[model samples]
Target: MDAGQIVEPPRILARRSGDGWVLYMDGVEPSYVRRLDGAIERGRVLMEAGKVPGVEHGAVLKIDLGDELNQRVKTSTQATADAHKAQVAAAAELRRTAAALNEHGLTGRDIAHVLGVSPQRVSQLLNDQHARG
Candidate 1:
C-alpha cells in the first residue's frame, strides 16, 4: 500500500490505561489483527471506549479518502495563490497612496500611521516602486 493509506477494518474504541490508547476489536480478523498489532507496535496511542486519552491537541489530521484530499490540496493551493495576489494588490494600492501622500508632502511615518503599517514597510514600498522603474 502507498504511504498515508489507512486500510479501514472493523474498529472498536478502547480507552488507554493511564492515558495510554488501545484499539480492542470485537472479533479480530487476520488482516484487522495484523494492522491493529502494527498500530500498537508503532506506539500509536489507542483509545478504548469511554476513555479520555491525551491526543496532540490542535493537530490537523488530513485524511484523504477518495478524491477529497486531492481536491482539498487544489483548493488550498488556489486559496494561497489568491491570498498572495491580494497582498500584491494591497501593496500596489499602498504604493499609490504613498505616492499621493508624498506628492502632498506627507512624511513616510505619517503615511505608515494612516495605512496602519510600520514606517519601515512604508519606506520599503516606496523603495520597491522606485526599483521597478
Candidate 2:
C-alpha cells in the first residue's frame, strides 16, 4: 500500500426487508440479521473474522446501509428517549397522585388498590413525593 493513499473501508450493503436485515459484502456470503443491532454487529464480526472478501483481518468495515436504515435507527433512538421522558413524567405524576390521595384520607392499601400497585409501592411513591418536597 502506498503511503498517504486512501484506503476505503470495506463496504457492506445492508437493508431491512420484511422482518429482517439483509447484508451483502463482496465475495462473502449474503446474510440476514434479525435484531436492530444485528447488522452492525454482523459487519464487525465479518471484518474481525477476515470474511469480507479481499479485506484483511481487523480491517475497518463501512456499513453503507442506505438512508432508510439510518433513519430507522435514528427514529428508534429518538423514540427510546421519548419513552424514557414519558416514563419519568408518569412516575412523577404517580407520586403526586399518591400524595394527593393520601391527603384525601386514603390509606396506603386503598391507594395501592386504586392504582393497581402494591401497598409498598404506594408508600414508596408517597415517600418519594415527600422527599422531593
Candidate 3:
C-alpha cells in the first residue's frame, strides 16, 4: 500500500482459534479477535476490517471521535459565560426590587426578609451603583 493512499474495501477477516479468535487481513495478522462465539464476534470482526460481510464492496471509514480537550474547553467557556450573565441579571433584578420595596416604605431588613436575601446584601445592592444596579 502506498503512503497517503487510502485503501479501498479494506479487507478484514476473522477465524476461530484455540478458545479465542484471530483477526487477519490480506493474509497479515493484525490483532487477536477476542470473545467470538456469536453474532457480536462477527460484528466486531467485520467492523475492524472496515468491511461488511456478505455485502459486496461494503466499506466505510471509521467514525472520527471528537477531540476531548477541545470539547472540554468549549464547554467550560460557555458555562463561565452563562454564569456571568446570570449573576449580572440577578443583581440588576435585586436592585430593582429593592428600589420598589423602598418606595413602599420597606426597610432593608424588610426587603431582605421578603426577598429571602441577607440585609447586608440588600444594603449593598441599594447603596452601590456598581453592584449590578
Candidate 4:
C-alpha cells in the first residue's frame, strides 16, 4: 500500500452503555486495509531477520489514564449532588422542627435560639405555615 492511500483518518466516538462504555470509529476502507497489510508484511520480514527489539514497556507510547485525568470531575459532580440533597433534607427537617417547637409553646425567639437562626427567619417560617393554612 502506498503512503498516499488514505486521505483521512478515521473519526473516533466514545459512548456510555448500560454495562459500561464502548468506542466506535469509521470502518477501515480497502486502501487502509492494504496499507495496514503492507505494514504487517514489513514487520513479518523484520521479525524473520530477528530485527525486533526486546518487549518492554518503554517501547510503547505512554498516555494519561483515568487516575491522571481531572479526578475532580467525578468527585466534584458527586459532591455537588450530595450537597444539594443534604440542603433539601435540612430544609425539610428545619420546617418540621420549627412546627414542633411552635406547637410546644416556643416563641420565634426561642425557636431561633434552639435552631441557631435569626428570630426573623423563625417568623418567616411560621408566617409561611400560616399563609399555607
Taking all chains together, each candidate's TM-score versus the true structure is 0.47, 0.54, 0.44, 0.46
- Residues 18-99 of candidate 1: C-alpha lDDT, one tens digit per residue: 3334444333321122233344422223322223232222111222233676698789999999999999998888888887
Arranged by lDDT, best first: 2, 3, 1, 4
- List candidate 1 segments past 4 Å from native: 1-65
- Expressed as tens digits, the lDDT of each residue in 3-89 for candidate 2 is 676666566676666787777776567778875566656765766575554354323334545788778978998999999999999
Choose the strongest candidate by TM-score. 2
lDDT of 3 at 128: 62
lDDT of each: 0.56, 0.77, 0.62, 0.55
Q: For candidate 4, lDDT tens digit of each residue in 1-133?
A: 4755543322323333444333332332211122232333333333334433321111221122256354766688799999999998887678778888999999889999999999999988777666756
Off by over 4 Å in 4: 1-71, 129-133
Highest lDDT, which number?
2
What's the C-alpha lDDT at position 21 in model 4? 32
What are the RMSD figures for all models against the true structure? Answer: 12.0, 7.4, 14.4, 17.4
- Point out the worst 10-residue segment of candidate 1 by lDDT: 55-64
**CA deviation > 4 Å runs, candidate 2:** 1-64
On residues 17-81, what C-alpha lDDT tens digit does candidate 3 reach at each position? 66655555442344554553432344445565554433243432221124685588689989999
| Clash-forming residue pairs, model 3 | none
